[model samples]
Target: MNRLKLISALCLLGATSAQAAPSSSGPIGPNIGYGDASNANTIYDPLANPANNALNAADTEGYRVGLGINAQTRIEIQDLEGASDYYDNQIDPLLNDVANAAQLETNLETFIANYDQGNISTISGVTVPLLIKTDSMAGGLSLDYTRQVGAAGIIIKGTGNVTPAADGTNLTINRGSAALGVTYKQLDEFALGYGFKAVTSGNSALTIGVTARYLTLLSNQNNVDLKQFIDDNATGSANFSDYVDGMDTGSSDSNLTADIGINWMADNYMIGLTGMNLTEPTFKVNNMTSTQTKYDYFSSLVPSDYKMKAQYRVSAQVYSENREWTLAGSYDLAESNDLNNNDTQWWSVGASYATNSAWYIPDVRFGLRGNLIGTEKTYTNVGLTLGFLNLDVATTTTDFSGVEDKQKDAGIMASAGVEFDF
Candidate 1:
């Protein structure tokens, strides 16, 4: 049993070697709406103008700054046999032995079943001026400028021990990130956006993206330590300390990446292809030898050194719209990468209805939108746009996996803001 536990721990740690970086943007639901511009908007429609970089003839004069906020929570639990193995190997062997192996198994099963029944993992944050959109129609050509700034973080609670322990305890990892983006659009259809950010203190990089009707491309530079920014801000916290220590300062490398997308509006369809980390760039961290010796050994055993290869993604959307109602469906191809095997490809379908009321308020439009991604997960968004103020709220299954044992891993995300055209 002890040997089994040790083996399990090693396996878990090995698995951690490829944990991919978290996504930098928010969820874009499946719906065709103007609010879909910023990735943060709950509308799922891929055809809708992305809030971050979209510009239209209506945005010709002055500037608009949209302050938006979103909060999301997710929880996962599984009746895992490997928990005991992990506990035995990574945690204290003597604290609690599997005196009654059968009983322990039963208990673990129950825990997994009820893990999300009562427990949840949450991520909450506020983004002010989530996007800045400006456009001008002059010289028979249109110019568009867009910018965004926001902060996000994740907090995980509850546990059946999914990852390796740092100090023989249930891993409690907290991660936070901040990002800023600027995009310029020309002739209402072509765009270029640049993004820079830091995730965990050790990971910092600059990304530049370009997009045209039916196509989008992106690229990035290599790991650049963010501690300098934190230190400059004089906001030193324990999280910052950990981030600084984890940074790989010795390696200075850059990555070349690209993505291409195509949209066919006449047929109510859209398709997109994206490639991430295409440059196969390699950036080495000095502490990797000591902090992650096992990873070093594992890497040596592989066919080649750690090279950042291109990750491919394909997505499509179909929509039908009328004066009072809209329906849409979308599919996103999942990339099979070493870092995230459990991550599966998924699709979403959604519907929405709009009505204008004259009884209570003047010029009031209310809409309800719902989306289902994959088999077991669903999200519904309710919104009201009165005059220049647009308010939206959404509820979604926090857990991406649609398994009953892990069903409790779900929650709601709500956002509200005003978009006024000047």
Candidate 2:
């Protein structure tokens, strides 16, 4: 019931539109990214570098632990409508009916119709340009605790991303809007893992890290074709459950995955290379039998094994004298990773200028983040660090109106965190 899995994710997750904290990636100051090692300390972060891995630019030796909360939400809709309508019509209403399969389909269909219009547009003097890219609307919440003793350290984290895959280049959405008609593929994941990180010594600039996680596959096929249900029984909307008792949407499974990383640093510069789910995780989910509820549609669990793809990233960073000015770049090699296979890969550059000052002045930091090569979105960040607390914010904007007579896509992501060291 893969479709059911999507419904579960959409209904279950409570995270809102926010920034990706990526706590384990270290304090990025005004920089925002998890896969960006060069910008966020990829040299010391295992996931960013994964091969083994750098300089403790902050002299972060001894014992250290950090605790924080992070949330990330990414959504794109046709810039034709007012931003408030997208929320009032899609996000908020769905937030209340997380279990209503029918309602979920209704809202999604509306979203798809609007989005498809943006994908195909013709310039007045040019041939029709087909943008084979999809929009992404994913949200997540995480709680993290990390501790390190000497060069060997451990980090424990729990993660959740709730929302089914909505991005598609040429989605035949109406292709399956019928009740008990088209089956929705399911995909949801939940996990907690302990990561091991360190360099050869306190002063070593080479580092690598690994993490073996207990993964749970909450995604499955979700079959709920309302039109099919109505036609099969030839009955009015009376006693809905009676007509589809056994076809209830609910099914799940679990598995395991690992991450590998490596990185190096020299002078005021750093580089990192890493792989997520390098082994390519998969699930041999139980084949749900299709129970006859409408037409040939059944809510039975269909058995199928799905591949969780792998992702690769490379990053580099440069710092000016006294670490005042910073420039960094990150490239997503897998673009479509197993964890978030639908979201587009982004080639991002983040630059920040931080000034170290006493309590009154605080450390003022500001930077620009954008997909200089991959996608069309651009983000800008501003941050302030007071003692142990850090506050950062960012906004995403895209203008594809050039093809659609001037339509725009816009979004925002923000986060805050604190750290302790001895």
Candidate 3:
């Protein structure tokens, strides 16, 4: 079904509805709503090299508690590629498709082909479910404490983020002076998960672990059009259940899943596999759209029924005899509906050098990967460990060579944390 129409349909055919109070913000847009974000262990960033769990598994260390804090931002801007008019004049019009109505899809495609040419990385108004979040303005500070007990571990995290009131509202956009608008979505999450080494034997050559987890929700909400925003907050006057299939309406829904991992450790080498959301649990999200009709008052929840796909990944590593140098790689095993389709199955390779405190610096690392499988750009990463502090930075560029001007084309994400041994 055409997404906008289906999004329209979500409101029309609700078996039930979930209450999600809408929020209003500046008509001009805001840089991440100041209300809050997530305290993600760099592990969840999905973009860090040092935080690669696969690498962690390959080089096992004694039990320790990793208390960390990090913040980062990544922005993707189209290079324009010599075609400025196509985006500035006709892009939003193409995106503002009428519900259940025909679209300028062909025109949009032709323009993209002429410029983007299957380069889904540049950005588009008509995108798959995965890219929807990219446009949303997001900002947050994170605080997390992790404990590693032998092959078992646990994590406790608290995060506060400033996110736009609604999905698709970017901090900055090519929309030009187009009288853009903003809607804020409240994002507050708290999670506790434990990793259990279900089995490890034969001189610790093989091991498998399962992490049971839950993310608590508290009045998670978003603002849509002016009318629904008021109705959704009418004190029990609104519900979006019947019209939606997989929407997680209001505060009455499940927010839990699990991950399983297996690793093989041999002399100087290790390879492992892990799967998240193994239970196949699915949830609903309120669909945010531009044009609103009578049905828009109903659900507008996207993926009305979706079983969040389980993600599986494979990783391997080789270590130097002296244990001072190591190399590792990460690759996803499948395409997951839970994330951007283009970002699925991304792989990264990196190398780390532990100086054994010889130079007063414990470790230094480097990583390289094709961002979105080189569909968008290339990412180069660096990591440093000085004293009790660890720092990691990742930079994105269209070309690997440093010749490209950094000012005009690049996105960056960097993180730092302090560690203590148990």
* lDDT of predicted model 1: 0.28
lDDT of 3: 0.34
User: Judged by lDDT, which candidate is best?
Assistant: 2
TM-score of each: 0.40, 0.53, 0.51
**All candidates in order of lDDT, best leading:** 2, 3, 1
Give one clash count per candidate, in the order shown.
18, 42, 34
Residue 292, candidate 1: Cα error in Å is 9.9
Predictions in order: lDDT = 0.28, 0.38, 0.34
Query: How well is each residue in 1-422 modelled by candidate 3, as lDDT tens digits?
Result: 01112112221321112111000000000001100000011223211111122222322332223333333223332332323344445544433333312334344434434432121111111100000011111111112222100000001111211111222221111111111111112122232333323344654445444444443321222223323322233323343332222223344235666666566655577677767667765444434333445223323322333344666667776776544566777666665531112233345677776543243656676776443432345567776766655566666754533312221345443444544322
lDDT of 1 by residue, 1-422 (tens): 12222222222322222111112112322121222222212211212222213321222233444433222222222233233334444343422343433444444334334322221122222222234444341111112222211111111122233222122221211111111111111111122332211111222121123322211211111111111222222332223223323321333323333333322222243334444334433433232221232222212211212343444444443333222333444343333222111232334344444322222232222222222221133445555555444455555543445423323334344444443232
Clashes of 2: 42
lDDT computed for candidate 2: 0.38
Residue runs of model 2 more than 4 Å from their true location after superposition: 1-35, 38-47, 50-55, 60-63, 78-204, 220-251, 284-306, 320-324, 338-340, 353-376, 398-408
Better of 2 and 3 by TM-score: 2
Stretches off by above 4 angstroms in model 1 are 1-209, 212-256, 267-324, 334-344, 354-420
Give one digit per residue, the lDDT tens place, for model 2 in 122-223.
000000101110112111111222221000000111122112222221111221232221112233323232322344444335655555544444333333
